[model samples]
Target: MMLNPAQARARLRKLIRGEERVFLFLDYDGTLVPLAATPGEARPSGPLLDLLARLCTCPGLRVAVVSGRGIADLEKLLPVRGLYLAGVHGLVIRYPDGEEVWREDRAGDAKKRVEELARKLEPLLEGKKGFLLENKSAALALHYRLASPREAVEVVRRICEEARPLLREAGFVLRTGKKVVEFCPARANKGEGVDFLLSGWRGAFPVYLGDDETDEDAFRAVAEKGAGVLVSGRPRETAARYRLAGPGDVALFLAEVLQDRSPDG
Candidate 1:
C-alpha cells in the first residue's frame, strides 16, 4: 500500500532510529529539484542546498547522490561537504576522500560521440523544439521535454531508432526516463552501485527514493535491506513497494522526519 504524506513522514522518522548510520542514496534531478525541460534548468533552490549542507553535519548520516548525470554535472549540482556521489547511473563515483572511480569511459572519452549525436539529432526533426543532449560518462541522454506533447513522443521514437544500432555496436544499453531517452554502457546501472554501497554499508536500514524507471534496479536491490519509494505513477514496471505524488511530497516527508521526535518518529 502507498503512504499518505503524514504516514510516510512518520514511517521515515521511525526508520532512522537515531542510529545516524544513514547511508542515504538519492536521485539528483527530479528528486532534489523539480524536473526541467533541460538539465541546465533543473537547479535546486539555495535553501534546499543549505539544508543539505546542514545535514552534512549529521554524524553517520552519510549521503550519496546517485544519478544518471556525469561526474562533472553532479559536482556542479552539489558542492556540499561530506557527501559521496555516483553519477552516470553508477558509472562514476566521487567521494569526499578525493577519489573518483568509473565503470565505463570517462566523460572525456564520450565527448566526440556526444557532440556528433547532438548535431545529428538536432537536424533530424523539423518544427520540433526542446530536444537536449546530456552527455554523461559513457552515456548520452536525448531529452525531449521542450518539444510539444505530440512532438515529444515522435522525437523519442525517432531518436531511439537512430541510436539503437550505434549504441549496440559500441556495447551500450538503452533506457528511458521522464521525457528523456538514454544510451549507456551496460556496465553502469543503479543495481551495481546500490549493491556496491551496501557491501560497505553498516547501516541497519537503507532507503532509496527515486521517481523514474531507471531507478527500478536500485529499488530491487534495496528491497531486502530497506525500502524504495516510487515518485511517479506513469505506467512503469517498478519493484517499488510505495509511491508518492511528486517532489513536493518528497521534501515534506523528509522535513517531517527531520523535525519529528515522537514515539513513532
Candidate 2:
C-alpha cells in the first residue's frame, strides 16, 4: 500500500531529523520534471535547478541524480556543480570532483552489440510515425510516446521480436518505462548505482524518488535502510512506501524540506 502525500512527507521529515546525514537519490524524468512527449522537451526549469543547488549547499545533505540518460546528456541538462550523477542507469557515474567511473568497463563488445542492434532497428522505424531510436552509447531506447496506444503496442512487439536475437547475443536486458523500452547492459541498473553511492557514506540515511519501472531497482535498494517515494497520480503496485501526486507535488515537498531547517540550525 502507498502512503498518502502528507503521511509520506511527515515520515521523511522524521527520518531526516533523526539522521545526522542524508543522501538523496533522485530520478530525473517524471520525478523532478513531468514527462514530456519527447525527452528533449522535459528540460528542468530554473527554479528546479535552483532548488537542487540549494539542496547541494545544505549541511549534511548530499544529492545524486540517477537516470537512464547518458553522462553527457545529464551534464548538459543539469548544470549544477557538486552533484553526483549516475548516467546510463549507473553504467557511468560522475562524482562531485569531476571524476568519472565506468561501471561497465568490461562490456566493450556488448556496447558494439547494442550499436549493431540500433542499426538493425533504424530501418524498422523509418516509416513509423512518432518512433524514436535513441542510442545512448551503452544503451538503446525506443520511444513511442507520441504514438497511439495501439500503435505503440504493435511497434514494441515487433521491435522486441526482431531484437530478441541481438539482445540474447549481447546479454542485454530490456526495460520498459513510460512510453519507452530500453536495451541496456545486464549489470547496469539503478540499484547497483544506489548501492555504489551509499557504500562510501556510512551511517547516512538514503531516500530515493522515482516514477518508473526502471526505478523499482532503486526502491528495493533503499528499502532496508531508508524510504522510496513514488511520484504518480494513480494507484499501482510498487515497492515505494510513499507517494506524491506528480512533479508539482515533488517540488512542493522539496521546498518544504528546505524550509524545515536541520536540528543544528
Number of clashing residue pairs in every model?
0, 0
RMSD of candidate 2 to the truth, in angstroms, is 1.6
Model 1 RMSD in Å is 3.3
Which residue pairs overlap in candidate 1's backbone?
A: none
Weakest 10 consecutive residues of candidate 2 by summed lDDT: 256-265
Top-TM-score candidate index: 2
lDDT of each: 0.74, 0.88
Q: Residues 1-265, candidate 2: write the lDDT tens digits.
A: 5678877887788877777888988999999999999999999999999988888878888999999998889999999987999998887899989998888866677668878999898888878899889988789999999988888898899999999898888888899888999999888899999999999898889999999999999999999999888889876888888888888988887876676643423
What is the C-alpha lDDT profile of model 1 across 39-130, one tens digit per residue? 88888788777666666556556667789998888788888887778888877788877688775654565656666666666667656667
**Reference-based TM-score of each model:** 0.86, 0.95
Cα error, candidate 2, residue 192 (Å) = 0.9
Model 2 lDDT vs. the true structure?
A: 0.88
